[model samples]
Target: MYFTFLGTGAGVPAKLRNTASMVLTMPEYQGDAWMFDCGEATQHQILHTSVKLSKIKKIFITHLHGDHIYGLPGVLGSRSFQGGDDQLTVFGPKGIKDFIEMSLSISSTYLKYPLEIIEIDEDGVIYEDKYFKVSAKELEHGITCYGYRIEEKDQPGTLLVDRLKAEGIMPGPIYREFKEKAAVTLPNGRTLNSSDYIGPDKKGRKIAVLGDTRICQAAVDLAEGVDVLIHESTFSHGMEEKAYDYFHSTSSQAAQTAKAANAAALILTHISSRFQEDDHLLLEEAREIFSPVYLAKDFWTYKID
Candidate 1:
């Protein structure tokens, strides 16, 4: 799976940035992409990228802020207009269902596809399947906002084909049975334990995407030990007072959360329009506290190994 940032701006769109929108593509894992926060002009941004609207299987909205959800109506309409008939599920806060219904109703739009809107009320495992599991936690925001934790299931390790071959075991359908079970009896009445010929179990990756909020322990809980932590840094350093008043976070505070949570990587997004010309300041400030920190830009792609 991989992540792509469609827009990384704060409240308003600037010349260099648009707003908050991202895609977590898992073609091999889920056969589609999962979107996070479809901000204003998000569809326009997708036009410049390789993302397909039909490949969108799920959408997660962090909050009901205009900047984070204004593009929902357009995106939903366009997805149907583009001949997308696949099932789509949206997970968001309590009022998200009303917002989507009202927008579609006011515009008189019809969808060819089945849409499932889930309004999250409590925090727990919101979604789970054979390959992945998703959980959410409430965070500190002006409104009821949430952060999501997406964890991929652990994969089986590689099979030691060479070791088995050395032991007079030939590669065939029997190898499949050996890989699934601890023992396999050969035609000659010999048995083998799969564990002795298997490598270590490959751990899966974890990702955390948080909404607009001040520094809080909930954010830390959402991002604890995650491989990738996507947090918002709406202001630069030395702007803690302004950040607090606006219910946002500074670069330093974001880095602190990442550091405290022990995240492997921190990506700071939702940049303010004031720093349109000097966005590097935000990255530089965040890196001072967290060595593996990053500042997201529009259309930038982050690969998760």
Candidate 2:
């Protein structure tokens, strides 16, 4: 799976940044993209990438702040015009259903596909499929907000084509059986154990995306052992007082959470505009606590293997 940063600025748009939006793309699904937060000008950001608007099947909103959800109606309308016919499921906090419906109604924008809106309130699994499961946990934002954990499902072992060929078992439906079960017997009275020919199944990656909030114990629990922790760091270490006053987290605090969670990497996003021209200090401050801490910029793309 690959994660593409669409926007990284906090609260408002800036000359170099939009707002909070991220795209999770997987190779198994054709052009399928899962968006995290559709902030203002999200549609415009898509124009610069290979991402197709019609392939967006799911959208997860972290909160109701204008910077997080102001672009939903436009994206929905654009998808309809772009010939998207599949059902779309949106998960968010309360008032999302009314907000989307009211906005679409007032704007006279109609969709050509089914739309499912789920209002989340607590920590639990919100979405599940054969490939992955997404869970949410409440955070300490001044208003209600959520942090999401996307855990990819365990996959099957790879088929050993060379071993099959050596055993005179030509490729056919038998390979599928061997991949799924313990063994496959050939017409020659020969039995092949799957474990002897197939490679070990690789563990799936886990990603945690934290929304606007202060440093809290719940955040640490949600991010435990994550491959990547996308947490908001809205202030520098020296601004701890201001961060607490505003119910936001400083760079060090976000790094500490990642360290506590034993995360392999941390991407610090939702940057304040005050240091638009100077992100090095913020990144350095965070790196002091977590060596793999990254400062996300608009349009940044990363692939996790």
Please list all clashing residue pairs in model 2, or write none if there are none. none
TM-scores of the models, in the order given? 0.96, 0.97
Q: In each prediction, how many residue pairs overlap at the backbone (N, C-alpha, C within less than 3 A)?
A: 0, 0
The TM-score of predicted model 1 comes to 0.96
Candidate 2 stretches with Cα past 4 Å from truth are: none
lDDT of every model, 2 decimals: 0.93, 0.90
Q: Among these predicted structures, which one has the highest TM-score?
A: 2
When summed lDDT is taken over every stretch of 10 residues in candidate 1, the lowest stretch is 23-32
lDDT of candidate 1 over 234-292, digit per residue (tens): 99999999988888999999999999999999999999999988989999999999979
At residue 182, candidate 2 shows an lDDT of: 84
Q: How accurate locally is residue 149 in candidate 1, as Cα lDDT from 0 to 100? A: 97
- What is the lDDT for 304 in model 2? 83
lDDT of 2 by residue, 160-204 (tens): 889889988888898888877787788888787889888888788
